[model samples]
Every structure is written in structure tokens, then in C-alpha cells.
Target chain A: MDIEALRQQYLQQLQTEEAAAPPPVTPEAVAQYVASDGRDDVKICQMIASLPLDRETFETSVRALLDIAADKSVGAVARLAALRQLGSAEFRAARFGPFHAEYIDLLRTLATDEDVEVRTAALERLTLTADPHALKLLSDGLQKVGDALVPAAKAVQLLARDDHGSALPIFRTLATEAKGQVREEALRALATDVKSAPLFERLAANKDEKTALRHIAAVNLKNISPPRFAKVARKLVLDENEDDKLRAAAVSAITHTPAVAEKVVTRRFATAVKKLRATTRSGALKSSIGRFSKVFGEG
Target chain B: MVNVSVKFPSYDSQGRAFVTWRPVEVKLTLAGAPAGASNVPVTVSAKSSAGGGALAFATTLTHLGTPSINLNLPANGAPVSVWVGGLYPKASASYGDVVLEVRAAAGNQLLGSQALMVRVRKNADDLTAAERDRFLSALATLNGSGTGRYTSFRDMHVGGPPDLEAHGGPGFLPWHRAYLLDFERELQAIDASVSLPYWRFDKAAPNLFSRAFIGLPDSLNRVQFSAGHPLLGWVAFGAAGIQRGRGVGPTTVPALFSEAQTLNTGGSLHASYSTFRNMQGNPHGSAHMSHGSGWITSPPTAPRDPVFFLLHCNVDRLWAKWQWAAKLHDPADPRSFTPAAGFPPGHRLNDALWPWCGPLAAPRPTTAPGGTLAASPMTAAPGLSPKCRDMIDYLGTVAAAHQAFAYDDVPFQK
Candidate 1:
């Protein structure tokens, strides 16, 4: 029961009124707009459950929503709305769970719909099930830049979820050839594969590289190879000439890597930190000291 | 009358319960117990000071211990200590609720009673059934189908007129801190035992996304809750329900960066506010993007979905943990903060945050959403016109700044 139900239970009642009821909704009023042939699929979806009519009308309304989802001529908004209404708690609870297989079939068909929204929504829903069917669609789409169902980057992102782990070639190609969100996501996917450790090291160490990508490389280096991460991190933290922000990331990596932090960050390193604190004007360099101070017993 | 005072060593200066899950040490000193009342057995228990079910399971202690305990009050009247460790996750709405009462075990003679101040924000997954229901009902009431006070919050995040001050800058973390606090305080105003619960998007949160809870999504990405779900009456701009679903990204669970990855966005063990703030692109931006087609995919339309609060709460939690771990509270310390040079007005350290401030001219959003900041029953450090600098020391660690809220995982430094 809600807090409101607790009211008036005692002589010293803590009575609070219930919130005002939402203005009445007339599902029937909206259902009148639907055509028997489901040409008005959008309106049919809006009031599918609360039809107030016989079971046949409700069933027809349900079928209309599903039909709209598959009908390419209906376009994105109406099609997506139909799928949404069919997947809603009301419809799902109305024994729509049995349509699970049928729903997947509809999604499989829509995954390659001409409209980006339709295609993307289909792929996203399919990705949730880790369905093998999406694997081929995403993979085949990856090889083509023009006729692709979705952008190569989005395809790589969704494909990275594959249970088969078969997207490494695609990830490598995109990581090298792509830019922006695509390359970034591809690099993230590549980081998990040990085979790409060397690439991570090169990017992490290259000073001329974009700081964002370098940061990703520097962090993943710890997991890829602890000794290598320590060596790179130690050099960066001590490099007073380096960008203070990047140096902060280096200091962070060593301090957080328990396995190598103690071995690499010795008493001499503590002296260096103290000296750096006294001389370095970089706030990022100074800010990186707190966690290091605690772990190494430096005040 | 038997006299006694309760002191929870773990409580703050305001004497409120900060950690609800753990056994907070409560010590009682017998001040004016009659001399005739010598070494005798007494029962200690917790009840609602205002009388209600808000404190329902409060007496249910951990380790199979009963709510009321039988302990002997020594003749010497030395202070007696008892651990108040119950899994009571709800926070009191008003000043507070839970009160401690002592009675003579024999004749059931009354002693003294004191209210236990509880006001804590908790994890959504950790909430008990009763606590979850209270939070949901209070949220529904506050929304009142989009016509209630929640519109103020939904409007605050649209981020157009004020130069998007709340995002893409140093103020993002601090601004959202105030936003979530204001929203949680409103919920508490409706029912004291309700604090906003956060969704740990890094983890697979079954409880948070279930139909019985925040609601699951349909095929079209429309969120669906079970029938009679309190959130059913949810309305935004007069429209009902929320629009959200899994993104076209890989897997639902790992699509966004994990907390470990996010905490070290610099790809190291830790990072500075300057570095970690870059998460605006990954986990933070990616988390929003992972919702696919929904109001949450972008800032201007984000808060329309109630999950926006939960999402931001976790973001704030990360900052809190980072601040705590690195001792990054002192705004005076140069190492504590470094906004990009020429960061927008509100993003600067001492500048007043908007929506919380009184209306202003062209530079500010043409319309302020919630009036001034909502007052917290706990503390007044973060005033109505809070500045970016005020939010840094949230735990009141080094500064007696603001202890308005506490997370289950982040312990109070005090």
C-alpha cells in the first residue's frame, strides 16, 4: 500500500490526500479512427488494447499493428509505432508472448528496410537476443559502404555484441580506415582481443597522437601487459615536458595497477613525486598525487 | 520519567542516520533513572514518531535478532550501547521518522524515546520491496501525470538557452548533483522515507528495468510497466508513459564503458576532473545513445524519461567516489579543479548555477524551471544560489559544505 493508505489509521492520523486522478482516457474514442483494413495502422495501435468492442475487433486491431510493422509503404513512424504497441506490456501480457517467434521473423524482414530508422530498430532489437541471423546481416553490410543497411560504424558497434566473436577483421579494418565514433568503438572492441596489444602500445606511446585515443591505449595497456604498462606509465609521469593531462593519466595507471604499482613506484619514485610537486606548475600533475600519496604513504 | 539520550556516533552534526544498511552504533546514557530502578531488564525498539508503516521493517534487525532487545540496565547506569543495524532502506520525509523507545521488560514501564533522523539516497537494486513501493508511489504522486511539480525538473535539463552549461563542461557533474538533490528532496517532501535510487548502468540491473519496477520496454522501445504500476499515470508534457529501449549497440550489458573503464577515462588508475569529464563522450554519452530511439538519447529531451534521474544519480556517484578517493574537495586547491580555460559562465568555479538561481537576462535560459534550489532537511550548505565550487565537497569532508545526501557505497569521511 502507498503512504496515502496509511492515513486515518490512528486517532492521531497522518492523513494526506491521494494525487488527483488523471483526466479520463477514452480508448474507444481513438479506436473509431482505425479502418477495418488496417490502413490507419497508427491509430489502430494507439487504442489496440482498450477497444471496448468484441474480441474480433481487438484481434483485428492487434493484427493491423503487426501488419503495419511489416508493410514497407507505411514508412518509419507508423511502422515503429505498430511494433512498439505490439511489444507494450498491455499487448505482451495479452498473450502476445506467443508471437515471440513471429515477432523475430517480422524484425528479420525489417532489419534491411529502406528506412534507416526501421533498419536500425530492427538490428537493435535483434542484437538483444544475440541472434545469429543479425551476424550475417551486420557482417555483409560491413563490407559495403554504399548499400549498407546502417553506417559501417554502427554496424561494427552492434556486431561487436556477436556471441561468435567473429568481428575482429571487421574491427581491425574499421579501426584503421574509419573515423570518429566508428573508429573509437572499433578500437574499444579491438582492445578486448589480446592480438591487438601491440597496436594499443604504439598508440598509447605516440605523443603526436590524439590525447583521447592515447588515453584509451594507456589504460588498456595495464590489462594487456602489466610490465609494459608500468614502464610506459613511469616514463610519462616523470616526463615533465609532456602534457600535464596525459601525465595525469599515466600517474593514474600506475597507482591503480596493484600488481605492478608497488614494483614500479619505489621510494625513488616517491622522491621524484615530491620533487615534481615542489617544481611542476601543472595542476594535473599535482592532482594526480593524492591517490599516489595514499598508496605510497606520501602525505 | 526515566531519562536517557541516544547518540549515534556515526550520525552527522544534525544527528541523522547516514548509513541505513549497516549497524549504526547507538549509545544511550541514563540521566535521571530513579534510584529505585536498579539493575533491571529493558526492551529497546524502533517505531515511527509520526505513527505509520514507513518504519515497518525497521525493528527487523539483521542476524535473526528481534526488533526489541532485552538488555539489563546496570545499577551504576553506565551508558549502554546497541547496534541499530537493520536493512531499512527508506528515508523519512519530514525532519525524520524512526524513534527509539525503551521499556521495562517486567511491567512494560516506559522510559524515553528519541527520533532517528534518516535521509539517505540509495541504490535502486538494493531497495527492499516495501522501500521500492514507497519510492515509486512518491515519484508517481510528484509527477501526478506530468501536471505536478516534476515538470520543473524535466524542464531544467533541456539545455539550450543557458549555453548547455550543465553538459560538455566542468559544471556537468556539479550541476547534475544539485538537480538530483532537488528532485530527491521533492520526493521526500511527498513521503519522507523515499530517497532517489540510482541505476548502475555499468551492471546488468534486473530490478531497475523489470516491469514490476521502473518498467521494461516494448519492441518499439516504449517502456512498459505492469498494470496498476504507479508509474502508469506517468505523463510528460501531457503525454503518457516513457519512450526508451535498448540501443542498436552490441549487447545491452556491455555496450557502454564499465565503471572501471569510466573511472579511469584517462585510461589509467585514476584521472583529474579535467580528464574524467571526457566521459561526456563515452559511458555517459554512450549510455544515453545505448537507449537507441528515445527521449534519453539527447540532452534537450532526456529528463522526459524518469530513468534520467537514476542515470544522472550514478554519474554523480562516480564523481563522489572519485572525489573521496583522491581528496578532491577543496576548490581552493588548484589540483582540485581545472575547467577548460574560458569555460562558459556557470561552468566556472564561483559562478552561480542556473535554474536554482533567480531569473536572469539573455545569457541565462529564457525560463528557469524549478524556482530556487529545494531546501534539504539535512543541511543548508548548498544554498538556493549554489555555485559550481559549492558542490565539490559534497560529503562535507574537509569543508562543512553539504552532507545533504549519502550513498550506500560512499561512506561519510566524518
Candidate 2:
């Protein structure tokens, strides 16, 4: 088949009937437009699967084809076909370079699509292109996020791995006003690795919150470091005369977590024992001591 | 604002000098209250915001009934104030330290204060000798031999005539209150210093319950309960029903009458001397009601607050009073253990009957319609049985017996 010639012919057919755009030349036209093998079965499958994603009902077709491609283990060609369905082919161009430059808009649209999978794909493609501007687009898309902000926040969290500074604000806002269940989940999203330490400190200082909130914050902070997290824990646990219940909570929070237990366990446990002995008339302090001892001993 | 001096008697306990107080003489003024002051109606709240806090009771003060607020003490002493809270009808922020004062209406007036600080302090401890005796007296009344069953009550459920229709149900709230009051009156007549501290279970429980259930204390030590612990579940369900179906508070947060209930009764520590258990436990004793009416077996903690000793005094006293009231109604009345509602009609014999019910549930025991014992103006126990004075005398007799047992134990020859 004269594949390139047929493609030109369809392009002219579409232009000739400008008002009607010739209703997206059928599957036959599509195969002709992209140039397919008439004989080799594997080549025929690849040709059928590699159809452009910008034709009429291309999104719907591309979605169904992608499902098939995924099930059948289609490779880079299917990824390219899926990328072309985007409003801008920015992701595709980034994946394949200026060879597919005419499809830049489709990729750009995918970069900002509400679908988490689409946005993630676009970001992954941008990573390959070494495009500094694509990173800005990811950051900009995050900036104006609406209710989709939860997924947006998750994506930004990943973005933080490379560009941590830009995603920090979104993480902070979510950590603050999100509902109790939401705040709990957001903690995991925002407090990955060692970078979540400062956010933990900010949450710890929020007095308007209930003891449980403060308790969780102290825990997250302790997860990040040694003497520093231990120091904050010490202030709370060693105070001796604070709300004993709250103090005990702070002690348990700071002493038991995975990261800082080794560094501060002995000191924190000893201090907790001493303070509990000195102040608690209710025997709660001593009970707290046993808890710390177990955690430190186990650790 | 009317400023009045409310005085309470100062007493010595184990070398510690303590004075008690109650909030009364509340003056209603809209001038300095929070926003919507004019729109707000007068509110009267008597509460204790102590370490183990609770709202004692609340009611609108319609008007000043008397200049002297009478309080009762254990033993036969004059009714006097341990502490008192009152409003200053004539004092204001503009008046510069001219606060209202509360003082003992009688006696040396050793305890007197015009400041809210002193009132709060006095109300905080919740223990006193008078309170102890009051509870003791109630126990004595209910447990007295001649007056010892549920039907001993000849009067209305409360102060009205005894009606078989009402039975002992919610209508018994006021009835129980009156019974407690009668017991309180008797305690006062014995020792005027004794007074009853009304408890508001709502405010006192928040911190306690939060610590017990939500916050981590020790799981065993925590009052770690939900709306599922059978008895408490009933209370929660009942209170919730009252609120939702009947427009009560959104939450069925019960008030804590005791500090001990919160701190001690957990896994690690067994403090049973707390007020929460005592107050919550009272209604539980009614077999006619639910068995676990939430009555506590003991105090949450030991060496309980001096207040606990007094609170129990009234509790024990009320039990005694109930016994006396029940017995006075029918000496042969055996319906004590029967559920308020008997078995299905036409069943001549009760499916379940107390030991005494076999005798009372017969035509022989049912007095004629106009018979003297049946239609007598007085519903008290027979003169041959026990008079009120005889009952009091018997209580003293029991006291003597207990004292003798404590002092004179026989030694076994080894």
C-alpha cells in the first residue's frame, strides 16, 4: 500500500471538506493513514495497535486499545499511541523528541489531565526529556489544583523527590486543614524520608489542636532524626509538671517510633522513669516507664 | 446584683482545718455577661470545676426564698452552712471590690466568704463530716428491720399518695429526690451541719471520660468504655434516646459525681472509691430497674477525698430510707424482688415472687375498701410496728451494735 500517499490523500480529503472535516476517515482509512502490513500477523497487530490517538473518537478508541495493549503486552509503540490521544502531544514529543514535534499540544494536555495515571505518565515522560520547562508545567498544574488536589498532592509529593521546594507548600496546607482522617493520610504523603522533619515541628507547635494531633506530629518528627527529635521529646517528657496524661502521650510518641529509638531510647526512658517517679501520684508515671522499657528493650 | 454573706462552719479533720461552701443567692444581671446578654434568660449553674470536675446541678433561681440557707450535718446538730455561694444584688464591676458575701446564718460564722475563689475552693473537695452522716442516715432508714421492703412506701411515688399505676420508674426521679431529701432532713435534724452536694454528671465526666476512653492511660486502668458495655450501654442508649427522641443534649455525657471513678479503676490500678461509680451505681441497685443500673460496688480509690466519705454517707442513708419506706407499706408485702410489672394478667400466682410476696399477693392480705388499716388517713407502719422516732431509735441501736462489735471482739482460746 502507498501508506504515506494515502495519508496525504486523507489529509487533503479532510481539508477539502473543511466544514465537515470528512468525519474522521474509518479504520480502513486509519490503517492506510499509518501504513500497515497486509501479510505478517505480528506486524499487522503492531500496525493496528499503533494507530494515531488524535482521530475522531480517538480518546475512546485509544482507551480501549490501551486496555488491549496492556493485556497483550504491547511495548513502546502502544505507549506512543496512548500518548498521542492527549490534547497536546507534549508527553509523546518528550518521550520521542522533535520527531513527533507536531503533537506537542497533546502531551501538554496530558501533563495537566485530572486523571492521575495520565498526569503521572506525562511527568515520567518529561523526566526523560530533561525538560526544565516540563517540571515547571508540573509545578504550575499543582499550583491551581481544586478538589483534585488530593491526587495532585500525591503527585506533587513524588515531584518533591526531584523538586522538593515547589511541592512543600501544598504538603504543608494539606497537613494543616485536612480533616482528621485526611490529615492522618497526608502525613504519610508529606513526611517521606528525612525532609518531613520541619513539617513535623510546625505541626507540633500548633496548640489549637487536640492532644492526639500533637501526639501524631511528635511521632512524625521523631521518625526523622536523632538528638533533635529526642530534644523535642525531652522537653515534653521531662517537663515533669505538665498535664501528666499529655506528657505520657508525648513520651510514648517520641520513644517508640523506628528511627530515633536507638539514639534516644535509653536517655528518654531513664528520664521518663525519673520524672514519673518524682511526680505521678496516680502510678501512671511508673506504668509509662514499663512501656518505654519494653520499647527500648525490644529495639 | 445582690451581695450576701454566706457562711459555712469550719471543721477540723485529722488536724486539717477545712471549710465547705455551696453556690446560692445567685443574682441575675445581664450587664456584664457574654454577647446576647439581653437576649439571654437568667441561668443558674452550681458546678465544681475541680481536678476531677463535674456540674453539681442547675436550676433557675426564681427568687430568694430565705436569707439563711440551711444545711444539715451528721449526728443531731443544727443545720448550718459548711459553705455557701450567693449573688450580690448590690455589687458590680463598677462598684470596686464590693463583692457579695456568704456566711453562716448562725453560730460563730468561722467560715465566711464573699469571693468566688473561696466558694470554688470550698466546693472543690466535696467531702465533709455532715455529708458522711447524711449518707449513713439514709442507709439506716432503708435497712431498718421493721421498715425493710419496697412497699414500705405508703405515700405517693414521690410526695404524693402511693399509686399502683406510676410504679417506680422515671416518675421515681422526683420520688427518689424526695426520699433523699427526707433522709437529708433527718440527718440535719440529727446534726445541722450536714448538707447534700447535688452533682451534675455532665461537666465532671468530659475530661475523665476522654482520658478513660480516648486518651491512652492504661487499657485496664482506662474507663475505656463505649456505648457497648451492657449497663453503660443502656445509659448511653437511654440518654441518646432522651436527647434525640426527646430533645436532650446531643451527647449522653453523664456527669461525674466522684473524682475517684476517673483516676483509679483501670487495669494497672484498682481505685474503686471514685464518685463516678457511687453516683452511677445508685440507680443500678433497683431490681425493678436494670440490675447494673450502673451502681458501683466500691469507691474507685482509697483514702478517698473527704468528700467521698460524705457522699457515701448519704448513699448508705438513702438505701436505709428505702428499706424503711418499703417495709412500712406492708409488713407482709413480699413483692420486693418482683419486676414492677407482674406476670400476665389472670395468673393468680406471680411467676416470680419475693419471699414476702406469697403472703401479700392474697385476698386475705388485701384489706377491705373502707377498712381502717385499708382506708386510714395515715399510711405509716402500724403503731405496734415502728414509729419514725422508733426507727431513728433503732438506727442508734444498730450504731451501738456495730460499735460494740468493733470494740469487743471475743478472743478464741488457743
Maximum-lDDT candidate = 1
Candidate 2, CAPRI quality class derived from DockQ = incorrect
Model 2, residue A288: C-alpha shift (Å)? 10
Question: What does the lDDT come to for candidate 2?
Answer: 0.31
Tell me the tens digit of each residue's lDDT in model 2 across B205-316: 2321232221212211112222111111111100100000010122333212122222112211112111112222222211111101111211111101112222333333
- lDDT, candidates in the order shown: 0.62, 0.31
Model 1, span A60-155: residue lDDT tens: 445655766786766477677555544431211223335557778898888888888888878866764457888788888777634578877667
lDDT, model 2, position A53 = 29
Residue B200 displacement in candidate 1 (angstroms): 0.6
TM-score versus the correct structure, for each prediction: 0.50, 0.23
Chain B TM-score for candidate 1:
0.77
lDDT of 2 at B256: 21
